[model samples]
Target: MKKTIIFIMLVAMNFFISCGNSTNSEITTQKENEIVSNNEENSDKENDEGKEEQIIKIEDNEEDEVVISKSQAYLDRYFQLEKELEDSLAGKYSGTTIDMKEAVSIEYDSWDELLNEIYGVLQEQLSEEEMKAVREEQIQWLTIRDSKAGESANEVEGGTMEPLVYESSLAQSTKERCYELINNYMK
Candidate 1:
């Protein structure tokens, strides 16, 4: 009778444990589904926002032609570009860790390209002295950008996450710099 009772107790304990695991698994699945649903809703909103942001480019016909167009337009376009890159990253975000790091680096590249383009435009618009100051400031900014990226990366040095953190910092910093240039210098 004692053996029988012990066997029955073991069975009951096993049943409870299996039930608990199933419940936990179900809860995790439910949370994942909700996240996917929310992301879809956010994507729909971003697409709608994209339709409304119209980017009109200001052409420079002469070496010193002033860009009378609203700087807001360029800013809007830059925002659009950022959204597109984010969408692209989201599409590939489910991949392995290395892929995520690469996605961030690619996004950084886009920001860097835009920065160079804006710098070129400023070169045409600003006089020699103004550009000299901007040039010095830009050099300083580059140093800061690199130092900041390194500092962030050092937090996770030699770990699998180092590249992702480093690249993300660079991308964020570059994006901020792009906006600063457009807001401060573009007329």
Candidate 2:
């Protein structure tokens, strides 16, 4: 049952975590670069590699290049490291239901923290009007997040796996929301 739950999570999460071409026509790329290191300018502080991955996006005009600060490379590297951490933690803490719970709980906590950071950054970075729009969207998102988490947990209601599923669901959805907030709202 636990394996089934984890498998479902991995499958569901793959959809959002995988990076593909942007829907916006304005975004283009001359070439995709290997995981380049982020500079002092626009990288996650948690990046230990001292290197940031690069995600190129050219404007439709071709002449005007658009480098979205604190996005792209940051997200790429952050997501990579995040995946590694989750896998590592899951392995480290697995065996018993208690251990699985710890791993997923940690994962959920990490994602929750990232959401807070992203939300704070957006609050500062977005304009008054844009912020208002996102603020409303965020309110709606919070409701959805709770409902989704509960629904996922209910799949195994009264079982030992219930809380584990709940936390993993929260972690997965919150992680997706982090990416959504960045890609859609972040400039």
Best candidate, TM-score:
1
Q: Model 2, residue 111: what's the lDDT?
A: 82
Off by over 4 Å in 2: 1-67, 92-94
Model 1: lowest-lDDT 10 consecutive positions: 55-64
Instruction: Residues 13-125, candidate 1: write the lDDT tens digits.
Output: 99999999999999999999999999999998998777545321222243223355546667987989988997888966679897887898898899989989889888887
What TM-score should be assigned to candidate 2? 0.61
Best by lDDT: 1
Error of 2 at 134 (Å): 0.8
**What lDDT score is found at residue 181 in candidate 2?**
89
Cα lDDT tens digits, model 2, 1-187, are 9999999999877755554434332234322222233343245664533433322223343333333656675587558859777678967465788888888888888888888888888887789999999989989988898899899999999999998998888888888888898898876
In candidate 1 the C-alpha lDDT for residue 93 amounts to 63
